[model samples]
Target: MTLELQGIGVSRGIAIGRAHILFHNQPDVREYLIPAFSIEQEVERLLDAIEQAKQQLKSIRNHIPANAPADVTSFIDTHILMLNDSSLTKVPVDMIRQRRCNAEWALQLQRDALINVFNEMDDPYLRTRRDDVDHVVNRIHRILADQEVADHEIADGRLKGHIIIAEDLTPADTVLMQHQGIAAFVTEHGGATSHTTILARSLGIPAIVGVESVRRYVQDNEPLIIDGEAGIMIAGADESTLKEYQQRRIAFDEHISSLSRYKSQPTRTRDGKTITLLANAELPEDITTISNAGAQGIGLYRTEFLYMNRLAPPEEEEQLAAYRDVVEGMNNQPVTIRTFDLGADKTVDGGRHLTQTVVTNPALGLRAIRLCLTQPAMFRTQLRAILRASAYGKIKIMFPMISTMHELLQARNLLEQCKLELDKEGMEYDRQVEIGAMIEIPASAVCAEMFARHVDFLSIGTNDLIQYTLAIDRIDDTVNYLYDPLHPAVLRLIHMTLEAGRKFNVPVSMCGEMAGDPRYTRLLLAMGLEHFSMHPNALLEIKQIINETDLSLLPANTLSIMEVSDALEADMLLEQINAPIIIKICLSFGFLIRTDKRILII
Candidate 1:
């Protein structure tokens, strides 16, 4: 009999292949007392395990295909950094010495302590980081128990052209499986915002996650079909069901092909309002996607990747070459490169040497502009490189996590110094390069007018803004339900920032996940935002939404909707305004019609 399953689809595509189940059961690490003298030996064993895990992560990272996206490297680097973190390294060693416990027991104790802190976190994104810690500890435990870690032998020509079914896959596990030509993956755990899912999306693989008991219901070599768009999985699928899905997949392909025609079309609403759609890039390979997606420019170029997965800070030449490639690749499109957003749990490339202290809560600790200001030499090198690259094309510099006027002034003063140094060296570069700040923290959002007066532009990074405003992590499943983008407070902050940008005559753009989603397109456009930057994959859908919208028709309803105090009511109001045939309004221009089944046509 054919059995169907439902899960949260994180990526879009389809595949039909034999199931290859990988067990991810937690290892049993029994607590047993060791002699005081053997404590030294146990500690050595633990350190060895940590070192071994780091080597494996590096090997996996190195194995990633050259054509793979930049974020894949970042995901692997994050795990490797965790292995090097004191909580995982020194804490377990101390536990072994102080508790006189075996290596496995001591590691588990430290893992629990770290996870407990994460569990108590108010943010959903940080709370899910507990899984990263869990995956690292499991790797070490496997080494301590002398067991073969899963995917250790994946390169031996085993897992090819199959659908991977697992309890859960770490980012490293996903990268390895991808290298082996795996068709798709189904996991029993993980939410849409998890790093694992993000990697899958970046790899363009079909994946479904959070399917409870999916591993138990399926077996190795079982024939299966995965519909990533519909979040449906079929085990031993019948011929009729397969045929139906096959046609749907063809239709999806056709729809994508149709979207390409609009690639060269201008992004204008029905009333002739033009919106600048930009791409958020982190890697050089991303420029191709951005150009293909017809983005007006690169709005947010995260520069942290240059400083990650290395032993030292990027030199001026190295940084210059990287930035120059992106600027040149985008042709004449403007590229706004954000400075290193490291610190917190995102430490990488021996950056701990720069900070020299472990941050208890990385979110509020030394990171972004704070870290840059604290390390002026390294910061100066980056500024010179960015300034040098600006001479090649339209390039802008952006600072992240600025919460006060003082910090922005301090950063601007440093920029002036870098410009002076460049002039002394007789280098020619763009002296009028635009500067921008990310409005993420509530204080910055509330004081957006102050920032607008000083900067050329302001970009809203709603990922952090919502997390900080609601005290909810977007990744934690426990409280993820409360992660509301439509919350009144979040909207108010956005409105204030937009109003300030208008009053000060500065461009305001949103470059977060919310910017990519089409659901909020009308609301944001009605709010007077003229620019949006998002992942390349979502650019087409948003463009479709923009073509059919009339900004004039939305002001009254959008204002009324924003005034609603309750989220549910506000949500209802938005739906009412977004309905396809509201008030039987006749249309002079093309309109998008979405049925109850959500099949869309424009």
Candidate 2:
């Protein structure tokens, strides 16, 4: 019997191979206990475990030669820093002493403190570092245990030559990914830049995610085909089906060879219009991927990730070093950094929520630009840091989730105050840094023209823009199906956003999931959108759409395209394309023939 699976495309490519299962399970605190003979023995146990962990990491870190690249060294340093950090080690050791609990129990108790911090941070970038902590804990767990047990070890004989599925995975688990390894990874949670995605991409594997019920659907050793590029799932395939893909698989390799030619070429449309191809990155490790993918700049540099893994906020000096690394790595290319957008949904030491107050709806709760305003001191610290880094490179600061004038005004005011303080210190700063607002909210979309006056440019975040505009929490399991970026309402706001931007003569760009999707790329380009920022993996496909786009007929296509009733029409329009397809066919031939136009996907 054949089976099919589907998932989001992270790094683009094609592969057809047998399943390679990677078992990733949470560390059982029960496993780390050592007989407590005395305080001396307990410390020795921990010290020994810590040492073993150091060696295992050093071995993995040294797998690549020393002269490989700076990024490789930094990746190893990340694990090293986490392993030696006092945040996880000190608190847990203190707990073991105070409570006289076993080391395993001590680890469990101390782990909560670290987990609490990660759960509270609203920044996705920072929130992602939770994986690093998990990595460290897992590393230590393996070191302290008597048996060399991990769910799946690549070097193990049983590990290679099978497809793997898990609830979730960490980077440490994925470190086992060797070249010509990791057939695929399917999990209940993750996006393109997820830990599993990174490992799979590095190993060039096909994967699917958010399958909703992957564990139930998949039987152990069930034959399956995971299509990474098309995001298709094909159950047992007939010989012809397999052969068709085989030819395409070979074509994919040839296609890859062709892309190398454009790796150094400027991204230009067939008409010779140039478009800046860039990457939306949060981690410093991501910067190299962007550069290697031949991206021109870093379009969205989410700063929250730096603060997520640790106990306290990063020091000013640490922040400076991070920014310098990113900017200097870009070699004068632009890096637009978005300030931290934290709220009740994302709590911190300085967070305004009543201590530990839990809110039901975090998306609508205080977050992004609003959180910064509530805590001006915290806000000023970030602003001051960005301005200080301005002298180092071409940095553009953008605020996320700005819904009203007051938020933008007060944020600007805080920025101005920081500028003065920097002035007094005789620090070199970008005297006039470009400021922008993410047009994610409905009110902001309609009022974008007014916003452009106060800001240098507008980058529409369609992911949240669609959600807030439609009053849908796309994350809500009940409404997840309603997350539509191609709905007419979404398009109009985009149209309005672009129109408003044009009126103000400010550059308008979209840095969202919608921008990266190939199907929507042409539709967006026809909607008068020129600037796009998306995942590093999406640049080539989106650019291909841009090159093949029939921009001439988009104005006429608008009426028919908008007439399609719903997302399915939009889906069909996207999935199929002719060499010189008319934009109008996409608009009219969609499945939205009968639905009401005003109803939103949410």
Candidate 3:
């Protein structure tokens, strides 16, 4: 009997191949119990592992197709860097010596520390890199602990006459499979935003993650057809289904190819409304993604990176150089630069100590503009750098956390201080630079009208607002279930903020994960959201959604759902509406989706 499995649909495409397990996670040695001179020995071992990982990464790089996309190269290059970084190897090796533990044990400790860092990042792109970091270190730890290099890739490459099934895949491992012609990939863990999913999408391969116990169903060499797009898999000898799927696959490929032609064009709806799309980036290198996507601007340029992955704060000049490059890249496009949003969980190296002995929650802890307001020097320097760079192109400064009127005033004061200092020193600055505040805090959301009066614009940071309002840490896997985007509290806050922005005649944009979900596009538009900022990759797709949507009825549809007492019902209502037609239907009637799950006519 074939044991069918289910998993989250990540990448789209079709494939059929054999079961091949990439390398198992490296052994997890908690620590070493050795005699004297143990630290020195562990250091040497780490060095050896570094060299080995380098050689392995080099081999992988060499095998990648010359025509392989730039992102593919980045994945390999980043893995190599992770393998070589002293932070991962050196510090852990030192810890092993200090604690009299083995290299595996030391690595385990370091892995814990690295995870702690990933947990601190507020930026999504930067936060996602943590997953990459975890995967890399986990692999290294397992490899060293297990003392094995399974020739899985080599064996499977030759045995291409089979299907691919596994528990889950790291982005790097998935890329490795691609080089081997593994055909299709299925894993038990991953999401729509995972790196593996993104790679598969970019590479035009079929992949499914979160499918459970797939190995129990398929024999190692069974012929299969994986419907990655629709999230289905067929095992062996279904000639009719196979033929039908093949035709569907062919059509899908043709359609995607057709869409590729619009890769460089502005996304306009079939009805002729031009939409603005911007990319979310971390490093300067990501600017290429913006150019490739033809984004209207850099929707979110995370500045936390300038603070994270290092022992000291980035100097003003260093920041200026980085900011100027992005400015130059976008040329005329606007870049919304949010301030460094550090919370109690994210401590600056030797800069600040926790004032509160123990805060129940750090996510709602002193973070973002709150942290900056508390640490004026860092805040001032960042402001100066941004103002200096603003002279290069269209740039707007946005503060991340502004709950009280004082925070906004303090932030503006800092901005002014930076400008005054720059002026006194004869440094070029954008004197009339516009400023905005992220309405992430409940206090700010409730008083958005007051906030609107103080800033040029408002951007709802749904990621934080949802977490704060529901008191759920979205990052904590254990309690993430409690985080609900459809919570009445969340809807009320968003609506109130958007309403405030509209009333004050200031633009309101959403720069949160919710903005990226197509399912919520109609709901958000219906909420009276005039602007949407999301990951640049979604610009065209979102534009497609926007073009097809009639803004007039979305509010009513949203209100209609809001009238419902059950969150499930609201979600079900949203799911029932198709993406392309939801807008047309809304515009046909002046309806809005409300917080109470009931329709309200405009």
Which is superior by lDDT, 1 or 2?
A: 1
Candidates 1 and 3: which is better by lDDT? Answer: 1
Ranking by TM-score: 2, 3, 1
Which sections of candidate 1 miss by over 4 Å?
1-8, 13-20, 24-163, 171-183, 191-195, 211-250, 344-360, 553-556, 581-602
Model 3 C-alpha lDDT per residue in residues 273-321, reported as the tens digit of each score: 5555666666687777667766788767889767754557888999999
lDDT of each: 0.82, 0.68, 0.70
Measured by TM-score, how close is model 2 to the native structure? 0.84
Which candidate, 2 or 3, has the higher lDDT?
A: 3
Q: For each candidate, what TM-score against the reference?
A: 0.76, 0.84, 0.83
Write down the worst ten-residue block by lDDT for model 3: 592-601
Pairs of residues clashing in candidate 1: 123-473, 124-472, 124-473, 125-473, 125-474, 344-362
lDDT by residue for model 1 over 1-602, one digit each (tens)? 98989887788877888999988656788999999878888888889989999999999999999867777887888899878777777877888888898989988887887677556443344456678888889988888888776652469757787999988989999999888889899998997767888899889789999788898899889999988756789997788767766765565566556667678889999999999999998888678778878999999998876775456788999999999999999998899999887664453543233555655776777778888888888889999999999999999999999999999999999999989988999997999999999999899999999999999999999999998999876665567668788888899999999999999999999998889876688888888888999998889878877887887776476766656788778777776656543222213223333222343333
Model 2 C-alpha lDDT versus the unseen true structure: 0.68
Sorted by lDDT (best first), the order is 1, 3, 2
